[model samples]
Target chain A: MDIFRRNNVTVAGNPQGPTVVLAHGFGCDQNMWRLTVPALADAYRLVLFDYVGCGRSDLTAFSEERYASLEGYARDVVEVCEALDLRDATFVGHSVSSMVGVLAAETAPERIGSLVMVAPSPRYVDDEGYHGGFSAQDIDELLASLDSNYLGWSAAMAPVIMGHPDRPELGEELKNSFCATDPDMARVFARTTFLSDTRDDLGRVKVPTLVLECVQDVIAPREVGAFVHQAIPGSSLVTLDTTGHCPHLSAPEATNEAIRDFLAGLPR
Target chain B: MIHTDQQPEPYESQNEGAPDIQSHRDSTPDAAFAALLEDSAEELYEAAPCGYLSTLMDGTIAKINATLLDWLGLERDAVLGRMRFADLLTVGGKLYHETHFAPLLRMQGDISGIAMELRCANGDRMPVLVSSVVKYGESGEPLLIRTTLFDARDRRAYEEELLRGRKAAEEARRQAEADRARLQDALTVLQKSLLPDTLPTIPGVETAAHYHIASPDRLGGDFYDVFPLDGERFAFFLGDVCGKGPQAAAVTSLTRYTLRAAALHDADPASALATLNTVLHDRYTGSGDPRYCTAIFGILTPGASPGRLTIQLASGGHPPAVVLRADGTAAFLPTPGGLLVGVLPDAHFATAETVLTPGDTLLLYTDGLTEARTGADRTSLYGDEALLAFAADHAGKSTVDVIGALTDLLASFGDGLDDDTALLALGVPPLTAQP
Candidate 1:
């Protein structure tokens, strides 16, 4: 169905500049990257796409079995790269999509040049030696929240965007607006995004990676960012003063500046 | 699908935080209050912290905990005196209470492990577990039936997870079984893929071959190859591989090919199977896995007399071929002292000359038939005595008739078939019928 599509809004900065792909987090399609996208377009050719089973993509293309593992979604990233035939593409993914980009970079290092992860988590569930913020019990509670009242939860959660809700920033309103889609996709996407565990492949990423951590995100807490930084070797981590899960949504100017600086410093 | 009966003003619905009602504080205070006030019946039987309820024989609200009343949105008036217990249950719950629960309780005085739903005061349905017991009066009369219900929200979530896991496990198992059967069927189809749809009838030599696979669950171990070698010389081989399933089937296919290819190198039946033995030994030796076969390979040369032939037989570990004599006596022909076809680096095969006179029969079979057992009496297997008796009755029978009857008899044995069976019977017409 047309429901599975991502309305990719392509923007070009300088004709000679390098290419960069932007990925939005859960509860949002590519449209949520609007504020950040305009700022990045001045220096780079920006490409963006929504994850399958989200946005306007074909929902029929989404499979419970195939997508049971988010690795398949990473594989989709590689295929999208191939379809575009883009060379040395730098990937910038937010929240869960950040982790997905990490996996995609690990899977196809030759195609992707570098990774800019916004509040990534290598694994959400705790392991023996590592604590990735949330416990298994906490995840269960989140799923219970979805089951209890999926619509009410989005309504309750939409107001929980980054920065002050009374005087919401542009990025916050963009995120709050992103949460206004049909709720069924929200539930399915939540299971796909929040419940994923991709820790085992973090060390395999050869590409240079940078994880932007929000100092106080209830979802994908700062501890999870530390875990990701530790798991992925030679990876630079910089903590964001902006609170909440979406730094790009709350502090787009700083978020865009951070991403631009990271990309500008990368190897030609 | 859900309705709430409480009509409190939306403004007064903020919650007072209790230790248990922490998350409930995010909703309305009245909701948190209802949680406590409605849980009375649930608190009764459902082990303190949770809600519990019980109903009488005539579906009356006989017992309840304080926790449930807080959940039901009722003040005891609407539920205690006026409503029946069935009224509290959802449509599916009421149906289960009448059919599976009630009848089981009446017959066994106890019914446990039932999942149902409770209709709350606001018409909201809650999942619950109901277990009941019937208490009999001292006068031997049916008394009140006691039913206990525990709020099953957490349990329902847990059960749904378990059901998903169980369904996934069952699906994996079922797929494995299906793949096993599909492989065997594919092997059988591949085996038939090699065979000509109909066998070429040798002039002056009447022939019939039947291959029986005891179980369809895996590939059969038995294999037979019959084809013309050269002018006036016809060849055939009946062999049994050492095991079952895909591995043995692979060996059977390889052995058939090796025999066919090696026969072109040497016309002797003994030499053909000798090459097959070397191939099997080399493929499986020292791998901690051993593969072997038992076989009886034969060659036939037609004679001047109508429907007469000279047959040379070379056997390896397989049972001796049965010769049904013209005079109505069946005895195993001596081709003993032969090694298993594919065990050692070098193995020897023994050849014996046997003549099937007019009205005679040659029955070549795998050991599966002779080892079959019926009931506890393992002695009553498809033994030598029974086969001899069967041969006497089938005197002067055609080759086709003999093989068909044996096939039907093998099927009748059912689970008695422990291994694969292949039977090939060739009968020569009586001299009196010859023109």
Candidate 2:
């Protein structure tokens, strides 16, 4: 019941530059965008809000049966955008957040401008015709891990998301906004987002798209980024020469350069 | 294999055969041996197979073992002197322990073997069955509470299986209820589809019919319909199909439609039954599962002048119909013999003719009313004699009065009557009023 307890926490960037909505992955919060936000703050109006039951959002607003679906998170993106009156804003999504943006854009077509898909994956399960990585049984094993050892799975999953935990700052940054989520909600979302098959909706994105791939990312690899590109017609793909899934945190300068170049090429 | 901490004999007893060992060893070897014993105690605590720890009187963790530390991926500096016992539980575990576990332990002196969870340093939670005992020093002073924990992976899987089984059972129950409702709706639709919503009013006839559905939860097997074939002639039928539920309901639908269609082709009631018998026998021939039913059909021919009806009655393996005489006398019209519908390819239905004068009434009823078994001698069914007796007492009454009596009689049976009942009554009302 206490999970629905939430307060507004938004970080606004620049008005002169383009607006960018930053969405963090499953574990971390709005703070995970620290490196990327600094570089784009002057050039883009950055708006960030926590998914309810994660980060600073209300915990009581979370329901196991309702929040158990990624449809809630996708709806949250739409509501937050409408609540803030964000129009034609660029969507910067990481990991599963990239698919959330796609759904948000599909829900309200006019609210989106261009999508900067960073390490996006439509599904974590492999099917007969599609290879989204991992199998349905493999995902079951991951769910078992959470049910058996929630903390162990959460901590184990952190390094896999952050890539290299030996760098204390990156590890510590992820640790800051983690416990802010209801573990039950996280478990449901983990199963849903990673297990979903959204191959049908990729053709519906009306806006321009840019797929960003990490050259050495173990979680969302270059092959996945290429797959996303193949699904979306006329979409451009760029593989960054970074080693982690979270390149903005590890190699910000190169990441910033790629994003800035893509934004400059837009039809002003 | 490692006996590093075995207790030794007393120093004075050992020194009896040796030098003044107490003086020589008191400063060096004895002190070293004491330190070795202490170190061994620490090693045993750290390397125990099951997790063991000591909590302060206030519940702060004073010491923990390496077995648990390794499970949590936590070094000693992180937990040994820092976090409290409650800090190791997940958010839900913490809430449960505070609301349930802590109160129980405080009142009970010790609570043992309770299933709980410990959140590891790496954010993974370990399910464990925990036991705790509080130690008191001399003079009844509370010292420290020692706790032990065992892994519960296999137990968690078993619990999940039970939860799934319960969930599946509940879903199955809900589905069965839904299926029952769906069958009832289909029966109602089929029943209405066959019968006329309103009965036809002949020139001199006050017709009233009632269909009592004993059970709306399952499909009823009774049916009745009244239709005008043409000019001054009208046709009416009331029947009961054997059995109940979806299968019987299906046959009822087919039988009702066949009777209507065949009557349109020929006014001969025998020909109509012949058509229905062929349809049912042919459709269900190969399968040894045969369906049968009882029915009474009548064609009412109005008088050429007025105020009368020449009614032709045809009954199939059904009960004898009652005709209350116009002059306050009730009697049964002779319908010789008829075969049950669908028993033979050429089933015969006997025909009879009766003239309904001004106040004569014709009553048609299924076996549910006459065959209702009740009383201390439940072996006796409500036969035709009882129905005729009941009708004789209510003679000269309007059709509604007789129908109301029959309806009350149906309600009186309660659970004794199992089959569906349908009754149709046509009485010529004194030729004064018209509906």
Best by DockQ: 2
Candidate 2, which segments miss by more than 4 Å at Cα? A1-268, B1-59, B63-67, B73-77, B98-114, B131-148, B200-204, B212-218, B242-247, B274-292, B304-307, B325-328, B342-348, B357-359, B430-435
TM-score of chain B of 2: 0.74
Q: What is the Cα-based lDDT of residue A179 in candidate 2?
A: 30
Tens-digit per-residue lDDT, A82-199, candidate 1? 6667678999987778778877887777778899998787666677887765566655544443333222324344333222337544333332233333345555666676578778
Error of 2 at A216 (Å): 43
Kindly report the interface RMSD of candidate 2, rounded to 1 decimal.
15.0
Cα deviation in Å at residue A70, candidate 2? 22
> Candidate 2's error at A85, in angstroms?
45
Clashing pairs counted in every model: 34, 14
TM-scores for all candidates?
0.42, 0.52
After aligning candidate 1 to the native by TM-score, how far in Å is the CA of A104 from where it should be?
58
Q: Every model's DockQ, to 2 decimals?
A: 0.01, 0.02
Native interface contacts retained, candidate 2: 0.00
lDDT values for all models: 0.68, 0.72
TM-score result, candidate 2: 0.52
Query: In candidate 2 chain B, what residue range of length 10 has the lowest lDDT sum?
Result: B1-10
